[model samples]
Target chain A: MIQVGVNGYGTIGKRVADAVAAQPDMVLRGVAKRSPNHEAESAVKREYDLYAADPDRTDEFEAVGLPPAGTLSDLLADVDVVVDCCPAGVGAQNRDIYDAHDVRVVFQGGEDATVADASFTARTAFETARDADAVRVVSCNSTGLARLLAPVAESFGVETARVTLIRRGGDPAQTDRGPINDIVPDPVGLPSHHGPDVNTVLPGVDVDTAALKAPVTAMHTHSVNVTLETTPTADEVRRLLADESRLFLIPEGAGIDGAGALKEYAMDLGRPRGDLWENCLWGESVHVSGRDLYLFQNVHQEADVVPENVDAIRAMATDTAAAESMATTDQALGVGLESRLDTDTELPDSITADD
Target chain B: MIQVGVNGYGTIGKRVADAVAAQPDMVLRGVAKRSPNHEAESAVKREYDLYAADPDRTDEFEAVGLPPAGTLSDLLADVDVVVDCCPAGVGAQNRDIYDAHDVRVVFQGGEDATVADASFTARTAFETARDADAVRVVSCNSTGLARLLAPVAESFGVETARVTLIRRGGDPAQTDRGPINDIVPDPVGLPSHHGPDVNTVLPGVDVDTAALKAPVTAMHTHSVNVTLETTPTADEVRRLLADESRLFLIPEGAGIDGAGALKEYAMDLGRPRGDLWENCLWGESVHVSGRDLYLFQNVHQEADVVPENVDAIRAMATDTAAAESMATTDQALGVGLESRLDTDTELPDSITADD
Candidate 1:
């Protein structure tokens, strides 16, 4: 089994650590935390070896009754690969430490593209990271965009794409960040960085994006409009997207109105942490006007990337094919099946009394 | 001077009555109310001849120390034209009343396009309603879309348009309507009626629309992406849009992030009731990738149609040209100047010490 070490046990790290532990082909060696906080204690309680991310804070962990397995360097030495989940710029700073230990590294989307050997999204470019030393998974938004566009690009040639992201102000736990009672055009400038970042994985697929922050914490919603080389009926496109394992086509009769209902549905399904690993796209919102396609999808910022992290770990450490690896990750994590079963029952009955 | 009567003294009726009173060539003959309420009292205090909309409620007006001048039929007989500002279906029911009086009529967007002789937006298809017996202004969202697309269609031929409307749950006073903590894919259906609505004013313009309701009361924000037949630079399109009097291209230096700030800016400018008569589009969000044009604009539902109602009145009652009528309405009601004066002073000084 490939041994895995997760560094930085915050919002993303803790989820990654749990996902790593769940994968049958991988063994969770440990998780690193800088401070001896509740997450560290939770990590220890879950039987994950807790390592002190900061060498200076090693003694602090022991003082808080949560003694470290060792320093981050010690944990890195033991594991075959490490998933660095530190906040944005901090991952770039930790690159040297990862290089010194000579372990395969998986970096989150926050770092610049130059920090890794290749930018990664499993469905888009899994082979690019195969047996590579390091690869960066694109941001949640980029992953969501690339996953939906990949099949469209393959079926009907993509001429151009324009997207407007109605983003959540913050995660549920983040209280300080806001536009609490407002909608702010983040960057308020032409072509937000999302387009360029998407290019890292998608190469030459033309995309321009603008984003605004709304007073929401559930998920980020994307209003996507793409021009295709050939026109496809809305039903044909809907069927094509439904075939994607990572895209959840929300049905009409389910009565799931918004992110609030989506979250409630996930919780009701007994999903761990109420996570949504797939893009929750409204099935009815899919439409075609001539050669243009329009739809809206909600991307759960916290959980969409968890399965990707698992797939990335396999891409670097194992010689498994992309499709097989993706299947393993989806099945082991219960990605798409639960949502289908629930929404299937909620669908309307076609054969009524009159029929 | 042309005498105008306003029926239904509510959110829109009161505003239309005031706008009519401010016009250089029009006179507010009276306003009709169904019952004696605070709004009726306010209208009487402002010296507007208050008439009872429901003949049964005429005695109720005097019972509350607010006597009505006459019934709605009496006010209709006195005025040369009447602006129907009642709720959605009520205006359609009142179509026969206007026909009976033989007076020209202007209907708000809530009424269907068939309720009048022609659908109207001052910037688009003004001639279609010229000297007609009746005209209906398109909805606020349609007005904003038609106004912005008219110039774009004129300068660069529009091939197709896709828009996503981030709609407010309700107007400020509408406490009963909501998706208060949710982002609902309103209608959750393919091609929401907005695209078809725009076609009323701007026929044969290939457009598709999707909408979601956010927990906001300030305004509706639209993410517009249009494909043009000819390629134009972003600056060229910006310059073209800037020339349109009704489109307020919000400058970069002004820190108006979202609808809340836009409202605050409007109130600060001392606009009547903080009404944004112009489409407040972010100047910097104008972007061009190949032949595609993208921008974001906020539409104030309460007031964007007020000026359109005025122009519709002119279209049906006078021989004034579209441009001349729009300019008169803008000048008398102060449509676009206040925003410019305030943002001009807030702009950054480029000629600094380094220069």
Candidate 2:
């Protein structure tokens, strides 16, 4: 079994550690954190070996009744692969250490593309990172876009894709982040960084993106429109998207109108941390007019990338094929089987050119 | 002077009555209310005539120590123009009463376009309603779109316009409305009714729109993208939008990033009811890439349509030219003069084709 160490036990780090632990092919070696806090205590309670990320904070860890299993260097030396969940720029800072240890590394999306040999999402570019030393999983928005566009480009041939990302202001625990009572054009720039980020995995796909932040903490909603080279009925497009394991086509009869109801549904199903690992696309929103296709999808910022990180680690350390690796990760983590609604609820007839 | 009666004295009604009272060329005949409440008492305190909209509820008004001047019919017969500010669909119900009285009527955007003889926004199609029996002022979002596009279409010539409206869940006083912690694909349909609404005034302009609802109560923010017939530098477009009296180009240094800050700025300026009567477009957001133009603008739902109603009144009752009537309305109600910051703060050099 491949041993994995998670660096930085924060929002994403803790979740990635839990995901790695669940994977049957891998074992979670430990998690590294700079300070001793509630998360550290919880990590210890869950029987995870907690390493001190900062050598200077080792004493503080023991003083807080959470003794360190080892230093970050010791953990790095022991593990076969490390998932660097350090905050955005810090991953680049940790690169030299990872290189010296000569271990495979998986970087989260927050790091710049240059920090990794390849940018990856399992469905789109898993082979690009096959047996590579390090790979970066693109951000939630980019992952959602790449996962969506890959199939569209393959089937209908995308000519131009334009999207407006209506982003949540913060995750539930980010109390200080804001626009609490407002909507703001985040970056207020044309073709925000998300478009170029999507190109990292799926090159030659022409996509333009704009983003705004609203007073919400649930999930990011994307309003997507794509001009295709060939026309397809909305029903055909819906069937195509439904084939993807990561895309959850929300049904109308479920009455899951928005993120709140979606979360409530997930909690009602007793999902761990009420996580939704799939892209929740409103099934009824799938529409086609001539060459134009439009729909909206919700990306859970906290959880969408967790599965990608798991698949990325496998791509770097194993010779497993992309589809097989993805299937293994999906089954091990219960990635796509969350729907309890009657998805067979009749949708309106496809909007087509004849209409 | 044109005598104006306001029916449905709720959020928009009270504001319109005050605006009419402020206009030198108009008189507030009275306001109509269905039942007695604090608003009725406040109207009485302001010494304005109050009419009971529901004849059966006249006793309810008298029971609360608020006496009605007469029924809604009396107010409708006395005024030269009546502004219908009832809730959505209620305006359609009130249409027969105004028609029976043979009075000129200005209906709010809530009513269907078929309810009026002409759809109106002062800047775009003022003359469409010149001396007409009735006209409808478009909604706040449409008014903002028209006001921004009129100058743009005049200067650059719009080929196609696409907008994604990030709508506030409800006005501040609307406690019953929600998606309180979620973002919803309101309608989840392509080319929402907003595109058609804009066509009601600025016909022949190709526009497609989509909208979402966020957990905000401050204002609606729009992500606007237009393909212009000719390319222009971002600076030129910024200057063009800045010249429009009703467009408040927010400067970068002023630190107004979103609706919350914009509303706070207005309240700090002591604007009545913290109303932003202008479209708050972030000047720095004005961007041009080849033939495509992009920007973001905020529309105050409670206030943007107020000035339109005032101008629609003149459009339906008098022969004033569009420019003169808009100027008069602007001057009397202080429409365009709210900046306290040094708008002269130099912006970054334009992002142009050559850049």
Candidate 3:
């Protein structure tokens, strides 16, 4: 069995640990926590072997009734692959440590693009993760854009892609962020850096991205406009998006208009924490004028990348093909099994349980 | 004072009555309802002179503990302009009645493009509403697109405009209608007829619009993609949008993301029914790639056209100029006063009370 260790226990880290536990072919070696905080307690509650990133902070865990399993060096030596969920820029700092241990690694989106040989977002360019010593999963926004753009790019050659990201202020747990009653331009110069992040995963497409952080923290909604090389009918575009398993095309009449009802639908389906793992696209909103395709979709900022990280793990450690790995990931996590999981369905034809 | 009568006390009529009441130069003559329903009772509570559209149903108001209102003919005789808020096709029937009384009329979007002399969306084409015998206000969706596009068209000519309308199933009070769980393609045709509605107002620009109805009632979100005649940077486009009084540019870090939080912001500011009179545009979402301009903004279906109706009243009945009429309407309604209305403002500079 493949052994995996998580180096951080924050938003993405805790989820990575749980996802590793769900994998049939993987055994979670352990997880590393910087402080003996509430999250450290959670790591222990899941029966994960806990290690302290700093040797001096090991006692912090012991004082909180949870003994540390080992030091970060020791954890690195034991696990075949260490999924680095450390804070931004810290991944680059830990690059030397990971190389010293000669352990394979997977980094989150927050890390700079250079930390990994190539940025990873499955389905869009899953093969890019293959045989790489280090891989970084693209940010939630990039993952969403890749997932959406890949299908279109494949169906019709894209000449130019433009996206406006309506971002949430912070994760639901992040209470320290501000601008509670105003909208400001973040990194307000030119094209946002998100386009380059998306390019790391999908380089062939010429893309421009702009973003705004809103006060609410539910999910990020993307307004995508793609100018394609070929002109397809609106129906053709709708069907193309509906075919992708990772894309949940919200059907009309389904009362699921925006992110609020989409979240409510997930909770109604008994999803853990009402998390919608798939990119929620309003199918009826997909329209094609001339060669341009326009649509609005919501990406659950915290949860979307969870499945992508799992796929990246298999891509790195195993010789699994991109399609096969994605299929296995989807089946294991129940990613595209909306019809079977949903007890109450408003649309007879809809395929996702997240509604 | 310009006297206006509203025929049909449904979603659009009640708001029109309230807006007319708030206008400095306008007085609401009365509102006509077919039956003494809950909405009609609301009209009475607001002190609007309620009239019965159906002469046979005059007793319905008295039976519901509400006093009788004059007949439709009597209401038409009193008001200089009759804003027809009747259902689809019903406005066409009422057209003859309005003409016989020699009173000017304003029709809602539900009526076809040919229902009036010309469809009007103030600011986009306030001149079209000028001294007309009859005028129909473009849809909430049209109003939003016109408001966003007019600036772009004026500054940089618009080659093409493509929009995808994520429409609400009904008004907040409308609970009986919906797909309940699906997103279906409404009017499953080429353009969904919204483009034609836009054309009736802005004839020079080539626009393509598609629409789908979601089970939401709060508001309709529009995904707009416009290819400009000249290529401008993202910064120039953003500054242009921010200058429009009718457009509220939701900046980055303001934390107001989705329709839910937007509604919350409105409620917090103590607006009646959490109504946002202006189009809520995510400022940071405005981006330019080559010549393409992309944006995402929401149109509050119930309240967006309320201010427009008042402007149309001034345009048709009074000798008020377009700019003057819009300014008077904006001030009386307490619009452009976000900073003042909001006790807790993240934006230190905004003066509008209705953020």
What is the two-chain DockQ of model 2?
0.01
Model 1 TM-score, 2 decimals: 0.50
For candidate 1, write residues A1-355 as lDDT tens digits: 9999999886678788888998999999999887664446557767889998889868766665678889999999998899988888788899999999999999999888888999899999899998689999899999999999999999988999999999888665444468777899997998899988888999889999998898776689999999999999999998899999999998654546678557645643446766789999998899999999999999998888888989999999989999999999999889983222222222211110000
Candidate 2: tens digits of C-alpha lDDT, residues A38-148: 456557767999998889879867765678999999999999899998877788899999999998898888888999999999998989888689999999889999989
Compared with the true structure, what per-residue lDDT tens digits does model 2 show for residues B1-355?
A: 9989998876688778889999989999999987564445556766889999989878766665677999999999899999988877787788789989988998888888898889999998999998578898998889989999989999999999999999888765444468677899886978799999999999989999999998676689999999999999999998898889999998654546677557645643436766789999988899999999999999998789899999999888888888998999888888884333433322111110000
**TM, chain A, every candidate:** 0.95, 0.95, 0.93
**Candidate number that wins on TM-score, 2 or 3:** 2
The segments of candidate 3 whose C-alpha lies over 4 angstroms from its true place after superposition are: A1-355, B337-355
lDDT, candidate 2, at B247: 96
Q: TM-score per candidate, in order?
A: 0.50, 0.51, 0.50
| lDDT at position A295, candidate 3 | 95
The true-versus-predicted C-alpha distance at residue A7 of model 3, in Å, is: 36
Among all windows of 10 consecutive residues in model 2 chain B, the one with the lowest summed lDDT is: B346-355
